[model samples]
Target: MHLPFWLTTALLFPVLLYQGKRARKHTPRLPEAQGSPCGQYGEGTPDIRFLVLGESTAAGVGASRHEQGLASQLALQLRERTGQTIAWHTFGVNGIRMGQLNQILASMELPQADVVLLSMGVNDTTGFTPRHRFRRQLLALREMLAPRYPGPICLLSVPPMHLFTALPSPLRQIMGWRARQLNRVYEQLARHAPGDFQYRSYPAITDVSLLASDGYHPSDKGYRAIAEVLACEDWFPDQPAP
Candidate 1:
């Protein structure tokens, strides 16, 4: 069954962003320092390199600029809390799926990160990607990341995909069901992964104002909420109340 045009576009958004990078000269570059409240846990030592990989949300799509994305804010928070620097890298494209992410990882030269945060699944469901494929790709990704970093690897749950609300009721129901199933897959994986690999699930904010103009991606406030959850994780401790 073919997904509708908007769903397809949403699924393919990351790829379009990646392809159009040179054309969008206006898009700001990712920040240099990588530490944030959640990101500071890994830095400097063999135990501190931080890498965030996934879709546009991981890339900070709705924010005004790249520096305002989730990865950048997390990095800044880490630096302030830890008094140590963290190097963050993002490999997120707008419409990327798990299979494509696997390919991306294979081709790219990633830093030796102590912590790896993956924000994905939203695109997969939106694209109607097969559940089997999603599971296989994610497992493969874990294997690839585990031997190298051996630290905390968190898989963020998919934020609620309410963009389809504007569609007919039937389509909306189908899309919502698909999205929930994807989130369940993520939740299950996080529960089962060995070692420090963890799953972090946050309630999806439904306030339309928190979303970008596209009515899909998270706005700055949305990204900030995501950062806050990561910060509270035991892996990424909060600074003492000032």
Candidate 2:
């Protein structure tokens, strides 16, 4: 944890608390996208298994169906690029902190995946998780995943909370500050992790229309835009799965 930052937050506690309550009361609660959470796209012999896990966005809260969400959109992009069938799955819970997500994963029998794209940070930021604890939780999650996933683990940087027009002034800035701190933790982990671990940031969405009606999660177009960027990076291995 950053001492100075936490001290500042402590000083602003009452105001932040009030703002948080107000925001919660006013923001519309949108359900996760309704559809099968797993699917296959394209056609080929050797296929790629892609998994998306983390928070609301990973759960497809902003789209009408899983096919229009990040997992499928990303699969489509990869299919177009590699001509290989992309089998994708998503596991995400709204308002889940890193520790909770880790616990849930420990209880599940997940399929082996060629690539893991994880979306995290917002809830942790808002929950005020200590920086060192966040680091430990992330490292633990990596260890748990490495055995099941023999491929790249891409950590998507926390979306810019400051950009969420739904939030009022100081609350938006404060949350954005916390988000940056967690993002730095992710960046540092990626920098030192083994070759398979990587980090990517969502492209800045300047247009308000790109966000869902809630102004928090990304709209379908936003998810597509993000998928385009992730695919263009070409982080997947060149060799076909055995």
Candidate 3:
């Protein structure tokens, strides 16, 4: 027996919505700036310099192009809001872990930056690296960056891992639970950080459509969501012209 077109569509709606919800559940939502307290930007021509250090997310893995990545979109937004020129540099690798990030920071002679945004941890959590060692290395890296960069040092919380929530049933539950645990660890580490460091908890981008086909990184919409959060918080005072 053949099914009516409308009936088939109607029947599929719930399943589709369920799948969408599940996809979103595993994805990270864009963070609200509610918990982040407002801070003053030092006077004079805001010497806005940004150094982004992290893994695939920072490198714009799921994005279609470089300009669509988190860094670029953030730069554009900052410029529009603060009306200050931003000098931004990005040091990202496809699958870098915390230890590797530390080593990279140590070996290279980086340009003096007023702001530093660290976007690591996801790979470390999902990758083979042990959590304890990863946390230690991250803390060390934080200490290292704090002293060197005079301005605000921010840590972008790991976006939700789609792999967990998007999986089938039992595996999804297990992965989702683990993702939350890791996120908590990240928050705790941020709280324990020394010096003028800020932790920005961005909501996990949940829309699967916002993710690239690989289902790992942010799509343009996801990146824009991140930029909106940063812009709302006035993270970058010296933004360049769009």
User: Using TM-score as the measure, which candidate wins?
Assistant: 2
lDDT of 2 by residue, 81-157 (tens): 87788889998998899999999999899966878889999999999998899989988888888788866578999
Off by over 4 Å in 3: 1-46, 162-166, 194-196, 236-242
- The runs of at least 3 residues in candidate 1 whose Cα sits more than 4 Å from the true structure, single-residue gaps closed, are 1-47, 81-84, 162-168, 236-242
Which 10-residue window in model 1 sums to the lowest lDDT?
A: 30-39
Per-candidate TM-scores read 0.73, 0.94, 0.70
Q: Sort by TM-score, best first: what order?
A: 2, 1, 3
lDDT, candidates in the order shown? 0.66, 0.86, 0.63
Model 3 vs truth, CA RMSD: 12.3
Per-residue CA lDDT of model 3 for 76-184, tens digit only, reads: 6776676666556666777678888888879888766777888876666545355567667766876687667755467787655535434555334434544555566
Q: At residue 242, what lDDT does model 3 achieve?
A: 37
Clashing pairs in 2: none
Better of 1 and 2 by TM-score: 2
Global CA lDDT computed for model 1: 0.66
Best-performing candidate as measured by lDDT: 2
State the displacement of the C-alpha of residue 196, model 2, in Å, after optimal TM-score superposition: 5.5
